[model samples]
Target: MPVYLSRTANFLLTEEQLKGLLKRYDINGDGRLSKKELQVAFRGLGLNFSGFRARRALQHADADNDGFITDEEMKELITYAAKWGFTVN
Candidate 1:
């Protein structure tokens, strides 16, 4: 017999969770995080970084150049952020 947990218990909003997870960086709440948004988030965390430098740092992940980090781009951004030198944490 297949015994499954309740929907609430099994439900894992991966996408929504990703959005909410990065909410701090998604200041506008447009479901995406922009360079400016990232800068703001980092600033809030006491990470001293310049506006121009911030955008450039995120450029590595912004392959499309749309000026925003999409859900697919989030992975790269996260990895890049951890290794990027622009951010002074």
Candidate 2:
């Protein structure tokens, strides 16, 4: 049988959580982090997300041609800030 936990059991994320996650991954601190940066973070955190796949995943999300990604774009690509090695709340 499948048991559903209470709402409290589910992790909820706040803006600060998102910001912290971004800051953690933002190695160069250029106000943004690129897919390569995320790849490094994922590797350090023991997560699985290929660099090529990650780039492909972030196709339209990369709003600026500068190559680095912004927080808003990451959120949009992941659909939520918590899934891509980021903490929620």
lDDT winner: 1
lDDT of 1 by residue, 1-89 (tens): 12112221433334344345456677666888777787776565345554754686568888788888888787666556545332212
- Candidate 2: give the clashing pairs: 13-89
Global CA lDDT computed for model 2: 0.55
Query: Which consecutive 10 residues in model 2 have the weakest lDDT in total?
Result: 1-10
Runs of candidate 1 with Cα error greater than 4 angstroms are: 1-21, 50-53, 84-89
Query: Candidate 1 at residue 51, lDDT?
Result: 72
Q: Summarize candidate 2's per-residue lDDT along 2-89 as a digit string, tens digits.
A: 2111222444455545445555877777767778876775465455655754565456567765566776666554443244544433
Clashes per candidate, residues 3 or more apart or on different chains:
0, 1
Candidate 1, which ten residues in sequence have the lowest lDDT sum?
A: 1-10
What TM-score does candidate 1 reach?
Answer: 0.61
The C-alpha stretches of model 2 lying farther than 4 A from their native spots are: 1-12, 80-89
For each candidate in turn, the TM-score is 0.61, 0.56
User: Residue 47's C-alpha lDDT in candidate 2?
Assistant: 52
